[model samples]
Target: MTTLEKKGSDGGGSSSQEAAARRGPAGPGRFMGGQGTEKSKDFKGSGKRMLGLLKRERPLLIGVLSLGTFSVAASVAGPKLLGDATNLIVEGSLGKAFAGYSSKAEAVAAQHGKGKGKVADLLSSVDFVPGHGMDYSAIGTVLLWVLVVYLVALVFGVFQGRLAALAINRAVFRLRQDVEAKLSRLPLSYFDKQPRGEVLSRVTNDIDNIGQSMQQTLGQVVNSLLTIVGVLAMMFWISPLLALIALASVPVSVVVAAKMGKRAQPQFIAQWKTTGKLNAHIEEMYTGHALVKVFGRQKEAAEIFRQENEALYASSFKAQFISGIIQPAMMLVGNINYVLVAVVGGLRVASGALSIGDVQAFIQYSRQFSQPLSQVASMANLVQSGVASAERVFELLDAPEQTADPVTPERPDELHGRVAFEDVSFRYDPEKPLIDGLSLKVEPGHTVAIVGPTGAGKTTMVNLLMRFYEVSGGRITLDGVDISAMTREELRSGIGMVLQDTWLFGGTIADNIAYGADGATREQVIEAARAAHVDRFVRTLPDGYDTVLDDEGTGVSAGEKQLITIARAFLAQPSILVLDEATSSVDTRTEVLIQRAMARLRSGRTSFVIAHRLSTIRDADVILVMENGSIVEQGNHDELIAAQGAYHRLYQAQFAQAVAEVD
Candidate 1:
């Protein structure tokens, strides 16, 4: 059996056993053991938060508006110039398309004699300059004006793009920094209830949506709205009756777009949520690939992945389909509006009721108006998605945080190496207390061992002393000072914890050892490593202390990783030490090495050892046997064995097992 199993068999083995069991047959789809028991409340008041965020960035919004207006103005000027050019060409410059050569006096008298204005009356109003060919110079002047207008329009286009790009980029950069800072300040409980994957999606994907909306769609929407307004006004100026018919398409398009956008927004949000979930499943599958193969559950894992993937695809399709239709439908409506205006204006020009210039200008204005409308319809989809993502981000930002570490916290004048828990009680959830009204104390320069069955709160006791969880109904003090009054960083800086679950980051061996004390010298690191028995192994490596390790030190054995954690703790040299099943992963021989190091480190500090192997703590000043959430016995090893109580019974069982192994 592995040393980890042996350690488990000796102390709190059943709890670990149950946890391992849950990793297999009973585990939930990719999100098993890490879920918190408590459910998070549904997020609320998102609009208020959004409004607040916008208010803080009012300057940016104003800048977008100003630039967008300028772009629209330049755009509008282009059509007017083209319309004037067309008018110049269509007038006398084209040299009388109609073949009638009668003067205005003769045509009007002839029309009066015929009782109503005949076609001659219409032709008479159109200046029939006798014997004059087309004025190409006038046409050239109009064309030149149109060309200059287009040139300025191009400049405005470039200006608008640059301004929008710069402002949005700067604004979004600042926004992300602010959001990240807010995340850092939030209490641990905020992370506790969320899957790491989902939280990261909000920080990354959701914000990316907002950026897309701003940088890609936001300016377009604004310019489009302004264009629509300007176009409508110009249409009205040309002919109010024609303008009224032209704008009939606007209300219909707006209603249709509003209905579609409302339906599409929720699906977009749901799509993002499912994508996050699917990514979580994929991450888990890759991370636990070895375990999946070892257990021969590959087929089951594949089915689980397929289901999540399908769900994400379905949501994405639904969202995109609805949003995608808005643009084409809007263009269809705009086209109809344009066709109606052209037909009406052409009739007015044919009847000599409007000038060719007026008809041409109205057509240009109508297109300008309808084009912005179409743009708005397209941008509506993006804006809705952005709002949806914004809502999710706001939800995360508004979550209730765990307790904050104290500000202006007390700092100790000197180190005493004493720790105490008085009437301490704690519950991860309020309804289920793990440690209930329990009290314990350890003096300076003493080694204490905690042993218990599964769910006996032995680890909880150590956690309380370390202040990972605050006590629900009591006080924990270090050196006779209440820990709640001290800053968490200050309190933690004075305590060293060596957990069984070893985590070694990717770095040089020396760097990993000195992680606990940022600026330790080479000699100090070597000494700590020697004390932890990793120095002997380090010297044998190709790079000695400079050997780089993979994440969590995959290059090293589990036992070696545990030793590195111990070396890190030793280097910290805190007033209080916690060895939480620290030597559990190492073999018996390596445990002996770690035990010797523990003895040396415990000489002048208050130390708490959660021991599974009873032999390692034979010299402990105090041994506490815990059952359920209460202490069943406490005394020196010899005294507990003499009493033949809970501790005595457990020790004999392990001893008998050891003897049987020898045989």
Candidate 2:
């Protein structure tokens, strides 16, 4: 068995798995090994948009085009120049073959004495130097010219490639930046609908595909086109008859390419789509490997992975195989053209209509011309695949952004954290209302403890207050000002949130704690750490506050991770606090320290707490018991207990559960 299989069973993850445990900012994360999930690709539209994107590098693109043109033009002159040298050698040799004769007529007279022979007719096209066996000096000069022209072409080609790379890199750089900004503008709810791996594939893999193809195929595409034009022009200049013969293959190449291209395009799209599905599967399984192992689902995970891998292979094979046929098919047409051009040129030379040197040059041009056609046909898969990837990236860029912050926004001169919801209504789906016409007011400097069973919309209420989701109807206000009238940034500025899932990036503990505030000092980080009871455990580690941690906080336990997050929130020192089971993760000793900190943190501040642990809210100034998105009862803990309502039953159930766990 493979190491992965031997160790664990971990199936993949997907948007399907993200059935949304956390509604908004902490959106849904589901497990379904899936990748390359995209809609029908728009090849033409994406190609156009990609072109438009590159237009920003207009001057560089134009420069590359010009250099490629000059380069190809210079290269096309090489065979003809070499042909001149060949003619020089032939003229000198024929001069010796027809020595004691000054002209073709004299040569014909000497050889046939009556008719102009085909050899003599061919010789008639060149002016021979009688008795000069070969003009070595003239041949050398022609070779030098050939060398200079080719060298110049080489220089231009080198610069053209460099400039092409520069332009393409710059364009891709801008594209990445646009994608980054687009992600920021997208609403939190948008992520709930997308698979994490698929989104990642679009942002990273698809964009990378675009960059790679543009770098490798962009300059080559332009150069191949220019080479065809230059070579065709040279072919016609040397011998229009042979040029027409070479042109015979054009319609065939075009027709074949068009047919094969249509077949290949869709396959490329399918290939990328399957890739995304596979990546999502891998990402999910890897992340949830431990769970899979504990459940002995490794065999199941492996089977799913194999299925996705097989799908990817099938798609990739079809795409490559279909596109691969074009190049060889184009080569077949080119070879036929080569034979026709060669035969025709030879006949023209014998007919005295062309010199042997011009026929050779014309034949070379035919080959050169057909070569570009084949080159272009060979690049079909790359072009199709790149455009498919491009469409995915464009889809991301074009996703509808969140509603913009209001212009001429208003905020209170001073915030007292008096928050109120005035008949608010909200639902993730219109058919299923989650919160409807819910109304409440929390006075400044009071702790409101929200207690409820799962799906009671406790978290949803806080999310609305945080403005992660706008209310479908009615308005929420703070300090007599509608929050909608305030920028999200400004409204969130005075609030600190510590969620059930603690997020710690790959950085030092000090930095993670300081992330709560802008440019917090070392002293402030240590103070916050102490308040959250993180300092004691942090000091037990080798590096203490300076100790580094992974994004998952791998070096620490789950409880420690939550403590660090609490410490971060403590440093923020906001006027309002949202703690979502913030104290539940820690040990009993640490919980005591955190409770003391929380008591101090709650003083002179409006706070909302979501807790399943009923004991924690006993000291809250007011306990709001919510059920089905409505406040069934609200009062101090003792008052709610005396009323014998939903809050009382919840407290009893928890007390019983606690007693059972102890037993």
Candidate 3:
């Protein structure tokens, strides 16, 4: 019996003091979530952690950066080269302007005599030849260089992209692997408090978001920032005054990004939170779809889904809308800077303080500087959304892990299933005592039956026995060795459990039956099925043992599913068997068949039978009636009835009507 049985929760959890251990629906603020308006408490901290995840890929990252640098360097040189070509054309045209002169210097000297004019000063820098037109050959040379430089940048860019992709994917792959390992390390109690869908969202949706965020932003942000720096250097080299004017927009762009990012971050967090919540609701409703239909809750479920969807849509829209403003806002600032630089450059050209070609290059540099800024702003949303997901993933990674397995674990030499609980005490809540100082022993090859009402700690005892939850005090031993000292694998390997809820994965009938025992042979599977009375029903199918079942085993009846699980247990052939109301789902005839099969399977093996129905376990060697986490009556059924205590009263109440009808 698991913790859910003790709480009687059909959903993830229920309201019970002891149920808190597993995590009730109304649990502490951590798992159940607080008011659903929560955001990442630490943004920069999570961002650092997200970046830190790429530590192992530092080499690949360095290679990517190296290629990107080369790429940017090549791209930056193109505008300057084009400017040089422009200078050639302007100088050649000036040579054509004074075509009748004997030399270009004579023409310039004729125009300005012995003193210098503004045009003459500008012409001093130009290499003008008499009768020369536009320098088509030189322009062609510069164009070829431009083409060569751009091609080089393109090659480097492709390689940079490949390397960056490899790095990001590898980091995400490792993160996925870490989360997978972490799930095994987490205690069952951790899951008890959290919805399955919420956890699933963290593993699938959140992690995927982290990968996408990094993929879309990491290299792009680096490239954009570097482009700004490279372009700034060239801008200042061309003309400091225009460069200053272009840079004036930086503060405004930064302000817009910072403010909008701050506002949008909470919305992204809310969006993901609502996503997890909605997934949980969908999963719950889908799992219990039959129940919803039976109860006619389709309209209510649809309405609830609509509300959550609306919440998700609102949060998403706000996040996107806020972040969306960044690009146009940045473009506005960039355009203003472009106009200022152009006007300033035109005046510089008019005064002959700078050549037209230099002013043209300066204008290009100004545009280059602002373009990357717009790109960075545009990708801000991906970065923010990714960081939000990173924060969530980090939460799962930071969740307190289960107690470590013993370094030097003990294992029983032989499998004699003598189990004992010695002065064992437990509590889901420290203040609320449960099963205090309770002690019980079961001999080898004997069956111990635990009968109790809901929340009576019958299931809790089994949970403790299975070491699902550690005992608050004392110890539990199997075959004279403390069970806690043994590794969980070793402890559980000796025991076989058939839970009330039959789980049959998507596989053939033979595979589901052979699931528990590794390397189970076909004969072994068939033999186990025969022993569990599953062979009779299975043989009637068209495909026989090869018949495939869906995840929920839809084609099979409830009795058939239970029988299949029983067959799985039989295949395991464990020394200790636990049957937790295994026959409850079957019909009277099927239940009788199961009891007979279980009796045979229990021979020479220590078995613990937990039954809610009283009549089934009347023949057990020992009967313990539990209430409020302690044994209130103990004996065989006949002896307990003679005592007329709790067990006798429960039996009478359950069977009195049947007894009257039969009499």
Candidate 4:
């Protein structure tokens, strides 16, 4: 049984003490300094790569840009048209006040009557207003045209938004698909060093951040930029002096935003890093909740979690606080510009150099100009965050993949299960070799038992055989063919493994049993379950073979889950079988049943049994004792006992322990 099972069954010390013993010292906060703390180094490169992803939908992007341009143009034209209507109304009203004329025609009529005008006198007198000089009809016509322009602008804006949204969604969809594909190609070594939660955050959180930024930032970026330019042109057309005064604030706002963005970028990077770290901690705590509770270490766990949470809060606050300064800073500059324009334009209007309507239009254009600038300034945080996330995603995409075979070789019609490891040397670290110059062979239909203490490199041998990790210095061959030459799928198809840690997906019992054998009939599944003795317990369940297993097979005991995996391997019917501590979790009776089933299952195939319980492999054809990184002794159980070697000592010790327990 595992340490956790022993601790829970025996009732250990206080939960905090148990947790501390299992976890050891905190290691000077090492968790905060590793891969979890890594930040994006090349923001520009990542941003460029992110933008490059959209190139695939160039036509859609072009359509979006064109629509955005037209929409902005129409919207800008509305203010200018409104200005023209205001100017006409003001001019007509002023005429009536100064000259007692209701319209231009009335003024012309009086002049013509005095003989200052010739033949046009009769027409002017007939068209003149009675009391006021203002022509309400002309002003109403101009206002109606302004309303039509505003309505058209609103329609274009709506269509532009729709098209932009569609384009962004399509681009983001393709981006997600590409990231998903990249994940499958990554090597196991990539996952081995990184925390699973951190990797998950990159896949789910980081990608989502990029998508959200694209959705809010893309269309607004294009529209805001266009609006700024269009608004500037209108301002210049109205009055150069006022335009100059408004433009003065542009440089100040730009400088302020640039400095603020620079300060905020590092904070944003730190924020994401801390966020990933916190997620990793939470995932770890959740997965090991049972162990924590069993040990009564909830307080310790909560303390550690609180520390991580505070770190995340600190980083997030700094990032947001720094970025927050941009808006108000830009607003202050905009307000100052507005005040200057009002004062200057007021002077020009009084001197008759500019009309009230032109002043009003210029003021509106100034606000429009400042609005886009403010938006762009505020968007700096989002863009930085997006780029940071993109960089992380790109890092995964750029990781080296497992080497592939140069050629796809055809599988032989028959595999005899003859295996050899020739002068093999392997190591996880280059400076320290774990398996050195090891040579071993197994004949067809022979059983080889491997017995070793923890870290004896026993599992490493199986790993090499299965090609989970390649041999460092030598080759492993199966049926006279180098295993590496064959495709991984083709080579692994003929080998069935039952690991100590049983893995069963969420599915019906029958479905899991049939997992190894595609297109397997119900009869085949039943036969395999019977062979593994899984049918004995499965039949007692309410739904029998149709019963659903939760993820991780939580509803079943460890022993039952192991039996299901055995049944799955049986259904595969591979040429070779490997049982690594297959009965480690079961009771004595269950182990007996499993041993019998495993024996039957291994009858005609070459088998490798890795066992800690010496009694389980006593009847094996040969037994190998491993110590450190090398095999020290090899023989059948009786032979090894007679020889009084390392195997004899191990078997004797276990036998004595079992006898003492019984006594």
Per-residue lDDT of candidate 4, residues 1-663 (tens digit):
000001010011122343444444543353353323334698788989999878877887787788888888888987888887777676565555536555556666576677765333322323234355677788888788778877776787777778777877787788788778877666544555566678888888988898888888988999999898889888989999999999999999999999998888777787777777678767877878898899888887777667677777777777788898998999999999999999999877755577778898998898898999999999988998888788888888888877775476745557999989899988765766778887888888999999977778777788778776678888888888888887777787888888787778889999989988889999999999998888988999999999999866877899898888888888988888888887887889878987888888789899999898998999899898988668898889888999998988888788899899999
Q: What is the lDDT of residue 396 in candidate 2?
A: 88
Clash totals, every prediction = 0, 19, 1, 6
Q: Give the TM-score of candidate 3.
A: 0.94
For residue 560, give model 2's deviation from the true position in Å: 0.6
lDDT by residue (tens digit), candidate 2, 197-267:
88899999999999998888889999999998888888878877788888889999999999998988877
Each candidate: RMSD to true structure? 5.1, 5.6, 3.5, 6.4
Clashing pairs in 3: 23-193
Residue 80 in candidate 3 has what lDDT?
A: 91
TM-score, predicted candidate 1 vs. hidden true structure: 0.88
* Candidate 1 C-alpha lDDT tens digits along 1-663: 001111112223343344445333433355333222221122234434433555555666677677667666766776666766666555564345433535545645656677755454455545545335567787788777767766775776677677677766766677688779889667544454455667778889888887787777756866777787777777777789888988798899989898887777767777777767666566667867999999998988887767667666776787789988888998888888889988988878767787677787888787777777778878766776676777778777667654676767776678787778888877655665567778888889899999977678787677666555567898988888898888777787777887777777788999888988878999999999999999989999999999999764867898888898889888888788888788988999988878887888899888888887899899999999998678889999999999989998889989999999999
Model 2 residue-pair collision total: 19
List ranges where model 3 is wrong by over 4 Å.
Answer: 1-37, 109-125, 659-663
Q: lDDT per prediction?
A: 0.74, 0.83, 0.85, 0.79
Q: Model 1 clash pairs?
A: none
What's model 2's TM-score? 0.94
Deviating ranges (above 4 Å) for candidate 1: 1-56, 93-132, 660-663
- Name the candidate that leads on lDDT: 3
- In model 4, the runs with Cα more than 4 Å from the true position are 1-39, 99-134, 407-413
Positional deviation of residue 440's Cα in model 2 after best superposition, in angstroms? 0.8
